[model samples]
Target chain A: MDIAYFPGCSLHAMAHEYDTSTRLVCQRLGINLYEVPDWNCCGATAAHSLDHHLSVGLSSRNLALVKDMNLKQMTTPCAGCFNRLKTASVELKQNDDLTAEIEKLAGISLTGAKEVEVAHTLQVIMEAVGMEGIKEQVIKPLNGMKLAAYSGCLITRPRAIAQFDDPEQPVALDHLLQALGAQPVHWSHKAECCGGGFAASDTDIVVDLGGQVLEAARQAGAEAIVAACPMCQTNLDTRQRAIEDERGIKYNLPIVYFTQLMGLAFSYSPRQMGLNRLLTSPTTLLRSRGLS
Target chain B: MSADFYKPMRLNEIDSSLQEEIKKVCDINVELCMECGKCTGGCSNAHIFDYTPRKIVQLVKLGAEKTLLSMDALWTCVSCQLCVDRCPSQINIPHIMDYIREKAHRQGVKTRRINVELFHDLMLNSIRKTGRVAEAPLMLNFNLRSRQYMKDAVLGGRMFLKGKLSPFSPVVKDIDHVRRLFKKIADNREG
Candidate 1:
């Protein structure tokens, strides 16, 4: 199946691995991701809080761009971008007056644009790609590997917007892990917030609050935490050091996007999954078990 | 846990017009509070607040505006959306807390440290100027405001090196269009 893709800003910059690996994995899964030409920033958390209309306007511009491309479904790898795009789509659909107002503001009509569907990279993999297909492609199944899934607030929350899974306790990632032949650790803080942009804007809160999710994952016996969003990956992976210092506890959990795990399951090499970008490498762990 | 554990600040003890505005906006149904302690149990920051979420909601239900105004619990919410997410009665407890905090600001109840107020000023100032946030200015302004000017020095400098974080705020094309819409919202809200 073919879908329009909007990678958003972070995927190009910080989460390049997610972008590349998703593309490669999608190719392996017989899915085509055509970029929405001239796509702009999704206005993420910044625009949403400051100017409500501008946030919707920015996201609508991208949605309209995808609609203009004649693709009804636009897949975004970043959870935050997906949330912003999906929420804006719902808002525009529900409030026509506001939609018209925003369309006029942008000088483009969203009238008759195909109903654009926004979904994360995971939804396409689990639902569209199918577990049986993944099981067939597993050159290296992560057998007996205990992993925890950490889905921060952006992907699951504001449940009215992204109705992909149960917001309170989602098992999409865990189910995907099992399909790849890995054990998913059970934990309660799956839908918790990793302080979002607060990690960059506010260090103290990130340390205190981000630590809670990490501890929950660790206590649940997860060797590594798997995530789909770039921000969540950066927070849990990049900021693990700060959390350890602040809390005086060693949490050497590896943060891997589900695509990287999928890449491995598809029999693709770690290099192809961009596994080298990880702060905590899964090479030693995967190799120790002769899987890598 | 203990009876004396929660000591709410008395609103009547502190007279402030800002508090009155807060009370007006919150419009919390003070009488409906069951003191069931659900909000307190679900709150992520109950440990930080002298008054738990249940106490705050109860205070609002009781029209204990002044006491609610002075409590630190009003500012502690991270806006995680969990309290409202789990509220069986579906109370918008966090929005009420934000409203109360805005009132506290008008009444000169502020963070003892300028560091935390840095975010408030940056977010509001950015919104006030553009009716939209410009990420470049927001981060630069935050760094300047918080005196963490050196914190993002290497990384931000690298971003500048890569031509990412430009020195100027990004102008969303035809921002006047958005300004007018914001004006309409303001007008309707006032009406």
Candidate 2:
């Protein structure tokens, strides 16, 4: 399947592994990712706080760009970007005045009301590729590697905008993990808030909230947590030391993007999937299981 | 022994106009909140927030504008929207929080959580100039502006060493168009 892609900011820098893995897995699965031309920031978490029309205008610019492409669909790996784009689409479609104002501000007519269908990569993989299709393409099963799927907020909240997922207890990530021959551990915080976009400003809240998610995943006996959102990845993977210091326990849990694990199951090397670039190394565990 | 007598003690500072503005701007039906406390119960940052999600709603409904605007809760709200998902009332707590924060920021209310606001503003400016954020410079700028020097020093070092921090800002093609968009937004110069 061919689709326009928006990598967001994280995929370019902090979460490049997610981007590379996404590319690798998509290649293996026969999916085409045509990046949206000259995409700007989706105005996540920031613009809405500053001005509502600004957020809608900024995010809808990408939608307008994609609409100009005559592309019926666009996919994003970052939950923040996905949420902003989806929100803008919903807002633009619902409010004719809003749509007119933003379109005029952006100097481009938005086709979001017509043909644009925004989706996250996990949705595309599970729904478009199908579990059986993914299972068939798995050259190397994950050997039952325990993975706790973490679906942070923005992807499923308010249910109306995201329009999919079991908002409280999402299972799409679990389904994708299972298809890759990984064990999807039963965990409650799969759809919990991860103190997103706060890691930079309020580090304490992220450490505390991220600690809860990691500890819960750990208590569920998950070897590692998998996330679709870069905010979740950075919060969980980047600050384990602080969480450990605060909680007085060692949680050496590595957070991997779902696409990276899928790439591993599909026989893509660590280098190819950019797994080696992870802050918290997945090497030792993969090597221990002779999967590396 | 009705609760109304006791309520006035805590809710004496009500401004009805604030409630009307919040409803108009944030689109939150604060009146729909049944005082279930489910939003507070599910709030991930409740411990940090001066007023938890349910209290914020109640306060807004009661028009506790000064309390809502002056306090750190408006700034500390992480905007995760768990309250929105779980709220039977369908109150978009995060959007309301954003609305309150925006209002407060515009009113020049100094907050204990100023760093969060600074970070958000910095992000907007960064995007305005660079088109996309360069992790290294963005973090450096955030640290410098927030005045909490080197908070992520060790992390930044490790990330730079690992090539995660791109020294050069990525300016997208047709960046002039992006600049024009920013100018339009900043000046309300378009449409």
**Chain A only TM-scores, each candidate in turn:** 0.97, 0.97
lDDT of 2 by residue, A1-292 (tens): 8899999988988788888899878878888999998898998888888777778877877887887777889999999999999988888877788888777766777754335889988888888888999999988899888989998887777688888788888988999889888889998799887778888888888888898998899999999999999989888878888899899989898888999888888888877887777788889879866678
For the predicted complex of model 2, DockQ is: 0.63
Candidate 1 ranges with C-alpha deviation above 4 Å: A112-114, B1-40, B49-76, B91-145, B152-191
Off by over 4 Å in 2: A111-114, B1-15, B188-191
Give the TM-score comparing model 1 with the true structure, all chains together: 0.77
lDDT leader: 2
Question: lDDT of model 2 at residue A210?
Answer: 91
Cα misplacement distance, residue A52 of candidate 2 (Å): 1.1
| Whole-model lDDT values for every prediction | 0.71, 0.82
| Per-prediction interface RMSD in Å | 5.3, 1.6
DockQ of candidate 1 (2 decimals):
0.16
| Residues B36-149 of candidate 2: C-alpha lDDT, one tens digit per residue | 999899887788776788878877877777777777777777777778888887888888887877778777898877888898889888888877777678788898887879
Span of ten consecutive residues with least summed lDDT in model 2 chain B: B1-10
